[model samples]
Target chain A: GESVGLHLPTLSVQEGDNSIINCAYSNSASDYFIWYKQESGKGPQFIIDIRSNMDKRQGQRVTVLLNKTVKHLSLQIAATQPGDSAVYFCAESGPSGYSTLTFGKGTMLLVSP
Target chain B: EAGVAQSPRYKIIEKRQSVAFWCNPISGHATLYWYQQILGQGPKLLIQFQNNGVVDDSQLPKDRFSAERLKGVDSTLKIQPAKLEDSAVYLCASSLAWTQFYNEQFFGPGTRLTVL
Candidate 1:
């Protein structure tokens, strides 16, 4: 069975510090990966995504690094703020036409001011 | 553009009761998805629709769950004779189309269901 999982259950960081959340996926066929942020009582919001063809992708304040050799993925947030506190999920999808996403157990990111 | 829209922000029902949730995807989007998010976990895909047709429903509990997407627009998911373990958030998401490449899915504020 294919599974995606986070390395940490929770990560606490101080404001103005950097945060890195790690994930491990078991599916070698997974070509598309995405990161989502979910606040309390809200749906998951898309943050950043990277394709298997690319190793790194950067958004406004976030970066996603994918290591195919180890099947590891990481999300890095710069200058973490209280507003960035939420549960972060890493999802992977196969190379099918539908591309159904399989999400991992989330990592709670707590940024304290 | 408006994001995905869902109704009944919250619901409370007893075991064996039935509940239905509604969702309206973004305009012109051809793909819709339903997911269940348990506490402290990530969302799991339950069903997927493409233009009023069923693309995938392998994860959906067929004995207790049913969904329909009519006219290739709005969709509704129903759960009959629910169980306590069914209590979770039902999220609806939509994308422009079903593709092999990156097609970002926009999600709606999910409906929280509590089964007592």
Candidate 2:
């Protein structure tokens, strides 16, 4: 059975501060991991992705780190803004390409302005 | 480039009533997927189609749910005799065909369903 879960259900941060969200997965066969940001009433938007071959990946203001040994994943947002307030989800696809992605229970990131 | 399209934006129905949702994937995408997102939870896969054929429907509740993709393009998902537990947001997403290492799934604004 493949399942992904987040360590925290809600993360609150002051404006302009940094935020870190963590996730853990049960499947070792997962090869690809992605982070998505979802605003109220909107779909989850792609933020960044990291592959098992790589330990870390960076985007405009976000970063995703993969720890295969612990089967853990993390997303970091620097200088978090009010606009960044939303639910963030981590998803994973397996060693096989074109496989169904398993998504973790999202973590709501509330950035206070 | 347009993203995936789904309708109606919202629906309210009573339990035991039937409902259906329509989805149009991004042009040229070979894979289409439907997901159910309950409040406070991540999206769960309902069904997947690689063109007009079914690739996976393992998580789908086949007893009351049904879906189809004709001509490998547009798709529809239907639930007969809906239950209160069937209430959730239905999301549609698509991705380009097998392209080696990168296959990004573009999602559409989902349809919010409420069964009272």
Candidate 3:
């Protein structure tokens, strides 16, 4: 199975600042990708997603940028808050649909006041 | 709409003991998924169900793990003779049909099992 890994295991950002987390996937066949945020003792929550057909997508205060040419994906959070601190994961899926989401190792985002 | 619900928020048992976890997806969801998350690692898929039928279980260790979604609305996962390594957070998620790319999964709080 192909692997998806984050450029950093942990990231710290100051409150009110923008934060960027990067992920790299090895499978070019992947056509869809999503970002999830997992709070302590809770399941992952959907953040944003992008399809291969597009290079970027935006959600409320969150943005996902995909560079298919490099097989890289990133999540950007605007106005980081302590409440946003959590482990973030980037998952990839092929045209097979949403049932087969392959996850990355994950990055812990710590927003400090 | 109510989010996915899971039971036994936390569990502790000795090695070789058996345990089960339950999950109820959001109303009208047709796709269900089970994943195992070890400490310091991301969640890994264990099984997936589409309606009342299984769509994938390739990563599941059938020798020790078994899951069922009897009526396709709720599901249960069982681990028999659990090992120390089996201690992790088991998460349940639900999505819409595969034909829709707008399908985004909603996850439950998860069951954290500790093997002592």
Candidate 4:
């Protein structure tokens, strides 16, 4: 089933703490996985990506871990800030990188100062 | 560099009416895509194009939906006889290339469509 309503899983963390968001994918053949951050009234912004060959990739303040065996993915944000409050989505590319991306039910991350 | 662009930030229409949305990809991006985002959900790919050529549209409701990218730069998505379930945000995204290697996709501020 798809999440088409206003209710979504929410995670709240205090500023300066580490926040972790998790996602589970169905397609085992997906070639690429990406994490996106979407703020209120704004489009989703790319945070980081990891190829199937690699299990971990890191960016400035974000890290993405891929577990092909369990078909799971997770995003970690260090030193969370107020600006990090937003909805986070994990997307996986279909068979090929050129094809469609299957997104998961997003998790809302709220940071309080 | 400029990011993807879309127009008609918001729209409200009655069921059975028609509507269209436009998108302009970032410079030199050959892959353009349209996605539908329902409330609290991730974006769902509707159509994909590579330099004016259709690559994928499996999820598109062909009966009432149509799209085009004649010059391979800009594109449009149209829906006729809209249904209440058609209410969602239309998002446009582009990537430099859609090859074996994965490239980052840049998305535009979507057009929010409300069907009553």
Candidate 5:
């Protein structure tokens, strides 16, 4: 059984501060991990992704760190803004290409301006 | 390029009622997926389709849920005798290549279904 889960259900951060959201997975076979942001009524938008071969990957203002040894993943947002206030989710897909991603219970990131 | 398209934007029905959702993926995308997102929870994979064929549906509740992708482009998901727990948003997404390593998934405005 493959399942991805998150640590926090909600996080509040002051504007311009850094925020980190954590996740844990039960499947070691997962090879690819992705972070997504969902606003009030929008679909999950891709933020960044990291493969099992790497420990960290950086995107525009977001970073995804993967720890295969512990089966954990984390998403970091720098200089969090009001627009960044939303629910963030971490998803993982197994090594088999074209596999469905198992998503964790999302964490609501509230940025207080 | 346009993203995935889904409708109607909102649906409300009573328990044990039947409801259907439609999705049109991005042009030229080979893979399409359906997901169910309950309030305050992450999206769960319901089904995956590689073109008109099924790729993965292990998590889908086959007893009351059924989906089809005709002509390998657009798809429809139907639920029969829907339960109150079935109340959630149905999201549809598509990727250009199914086997590519870094293919980004483009999503649609999900159909929010409310079962009373």
Candidate 6:
């Protein structure tokens, strides 16, 4: 079945440094993508999202880059902080109008101070 | 505003037993979703409800798993004769409406279930 996946299972970085998490999706028909942050013992929180029509979208200190030609997506966080330590997941939804999301395995991001 | 709410943060039940989890979505939200998230993996949609009607439930184990969203507000997910593989976190989320375009969903803390 078509699915979403990540390049790295875990990413470690020091505080104040930049971090980039990469995801690869197999469904070309998907039109919308979202990045979520899940802390320990909590549900996933929406971070940022990008539509297929756009190549890039930015929110707060996070940026989402979408490459439809390769079916690849990436999330960039500027000035990483300790609070950013969590599992980050990239979810895809779409060719239809409904908002059903298909999530990836997720990449754990560790930010050490 | 309050986010989605779920009950019984944790539950431990033996296999073959029955367990039910409750959820209360954000006020005025017309769409509700239930997802199962196993350890180290991302949340998988189990069912989706538009108002009180089911919109999607293809992934749900209909033989053993059942759900209901009554009054278009609170919902309950029940598992009969639970299996060990049912051990996972159940998350409830709600969106203002179901649209062709993207609508942000607000998630609850989640209910952790352990089927031993």
For each candidate, the alpha-carbon lDDT, in order, equals 0.90, 0.88, 0.88, 0.91, 0.87, 0.91
What is the TM-score of candidate 6? 0.96
lDDT tens per residue, model 6, B1-116: 88899999999999999999999999999999999998888999999999999999999999999999989999999999899999999999999999888899889999899999
Candidate 5 interface RMSD value:
5.3
Clashing pairs for model 1 are: none
Q: What TM-score does the predicted chain A of each candidate obtain versus native chain A? A: 0.91, 0.90, 0.89, 0.93, 0.90, 0.91
The sequence of per-residue lDDT tens digits that candidate 2 reaches over residues B79-104 is: 99899999888999998975446588
Candidate 4 at B64: error in angstroms?
A: 0.5
Winner on lDDT (2 vs 4): 4
After aligning candidate 1 to the native by TM-score, how far in Å is the CA of A69 from where it should be? 1.1
Best by DockQ: 4
Model 4 ranges off by over 4 Å: A1-5
**What are the TM-scores, per candidate, against the unseen true structure?**
0.95, 0.94, 0.93, 0.96, 0.93, 0.96
Residue pairs with colliding backbones in model 5 are: none
**Could you tell me the interface RMSD of model 1?**
5.2
Better of 1 and 4 by DockQ: 4
Candidates by DockQ, descending order: 4, 6, 1, 3, 5, 2
Per-residue lDDT of model 4, residues B1-116, tens digit only: 88888999888999999999999999999999999999989999999999999999999999999999999999999999899999999999999988977889899989899999
> Across residues A1-113, which tens digit of lDDT does each residue of candidate 3 receive?
11122343889889999999999987898888999998888899988889989998999999999999999999999999999988899999886564388888799888889
The positional error of residue B106 in candidate 5, measured at the CA in angstroms, is 1.7
TM-score of 1: 0.95
Model 5 residue B5 CA deviation in Å: 0.9
lDDT of 1 at A62: 97
Predict model 4's lDDT versus the native.
Answer: 0.91
Instruction: Please list, in the order the candidates appear, how each scores on TM-score for chain B only.
Output: 0.98, 0.96, 0.96, 0.98, 0.97, 0.99
Candidate 2's C-alpha runs over 4 A off are A1-8, B99-102
